[model samples]
Target: MTQDKHSRRRMLAMVGGALAMPSVLRAQATDPTVVGGTAEARRNISSFRTQRWEDHFDSLGVATLLADTQSRALHYWSADGSDYRLYPTSVPMSEELTKRGYTKVVRKRVGPDWTPTQNMLARDPSLKYMPPGPDNPLGTHALYLDWPAYLIHGTHDTRKIGRRSSSGCIGLYNEKIAELYELAPVGTQVRLI
Candidate 1:
């Protein structure tokens, strides 16, 4: 009798799962945002696929940084092609706030400060300047791009790393930015797409 009960319970569980499978498949197909199985998994997800530098740039001058906003990942290649690193990043909150196309790292700074841009201030009058520290939005390191007010910088907030959370910058975790800062010299070619 015990064996029969156990067998029946197993059969019921299988039937229930089979009934739920269609809804699960439909959800996965219809929703682009649905990934993995949990909220934590979705928020932390960044698709890190292997990328060839030649596909993006003519040459790895100094180094190269390709920030793919769609995938929420940053790809790096060394000038000599000896090193490559992929980092999950926070992209601009919206496409209107994003700046695309080619640029280069024009400057590098440790302990970078934060000052709201005119547009930022216009949107939020409460915004003010912030000196470099734990609270600074730019975190520990910053690689200023050739475009005015654009940067590939670090963020103290780890939750922002794999989300669309930045104002207009590509943001890495502080530790990751520190490593990139060491490897990516000023003049590293950068592209945002």
Candidate 2:
């Protein structure tokens, strides 16, 4: 009967759609969502580019952070002659930090505590003190540079890495910065060009 065939077709379609819905839900759950205030989505896969082929240090034996404002990425060099596979990281940028020149690491701290600057608090009093943790702005490690206004540090939100959303200091993915923190000692020179 025509009526019976139409009912059977509608039931089959509903069953098929219902079976497919869970897969779509699972994919959305697995994918990471946006965090903090990032303009771009986070990328997991990265290919390293040759920033410098020769050891420009000439075996001076000091790790360095070569931060490029234009690229919004930081390149790390090991004084020990070990080459690291490249990972493109998102770096924070602002109008004032376009030219930082060269600065040295003044201090280093792990699980660094974060307190909003008086200047920051003045502007946004609603911002509260954030304790150190996975949610902390400073993330796992922080390397203070000679410039008090800025430093090289890790971020809790991996999404913010490639975005120009930080107050001023450059931020790296948590694992990347942690690796650098262990390798780079205080007084390591950081050049921004």
Candidate 3:
């Protein structure tokens, strides 16, 4: 009877360790300085905290957007400082794919088309131009940044939100992008960190 109890305890211990292994692997794989996917990853990456715009911008000229790639959250403050909003976002999959610095919303587009970047084409030669529609990767609205080929846009793939899924652009949900598109006009100052 004692042997049977020990055997059961050993089995439970092995199962518990097996269940804990993924989290251990994920923690080791995650970079505290960069955003990551999954709820556990979020906890590991700063708990998706909110930040003040003043810390990122000298003034809320027109508007301000701070994309905290580390936390996978976007912070927005209106020009008048009366409105502040935070949204979960999908950041670049890797640090090399991320662009960190200040830029501005130079333009905005509704139902934007998707054209593979030069690097994207080089990687997948089969990639072709995609027109604006459900199949488009840019979703319902797009906020074009001063950096060419980089954007704060919507994605039809809701699964991408809160995950490290984008090639280089920051992605939001379709409805959220539409709302943001209406709020953030041209020349909204943006910083990606």
Error of 3 at 90 (Å): 0.8
- What's the candidate order when arranged by decreasing TM-score? 1, 3, 2
TM-score for each of the candidates: 0.80, 0.65, 0.77
Each candidate's root-mean-square deviation in Å?
A: 6.7, 9.7, 6.1
Q: Higher-TM-score candidate among 2 and 3? A: 3
- Residue-by-residue lDDT tens digits, candidate 3, 1-193: 9999999999999999999998775554333344365323324433476476877788999999999897888989999999999888999998889999999999999999999999888878998999999989999999999999999999999999988999899999999999999999999999999
lDDT of 1 by residue, 89-189 (tens): 99999888999999999999999999999989988999999999999999999999989999999999998988998889999999999999999998899
Q: Report lDDT (CA) for all predictions.
A: 0.88, 0.70, 0.89
**For model 3, the run of ten residues with the poorest summed lDDT:** 38-47
Ranking by lDDT: 3, 1, 2
Backbone clashes in model 1: 0
lDDT of 2 by residue, 97-175 (tens): 4446778788999998888887678768988888889778888999998887577888878888667767777788889
Worst 10-residue lDDT window for candidate 2 reads 40-49
Which candidate ranks first by lDDT, i.e. highest? 3
Tell me, by TM-score, which candidate is best. 1
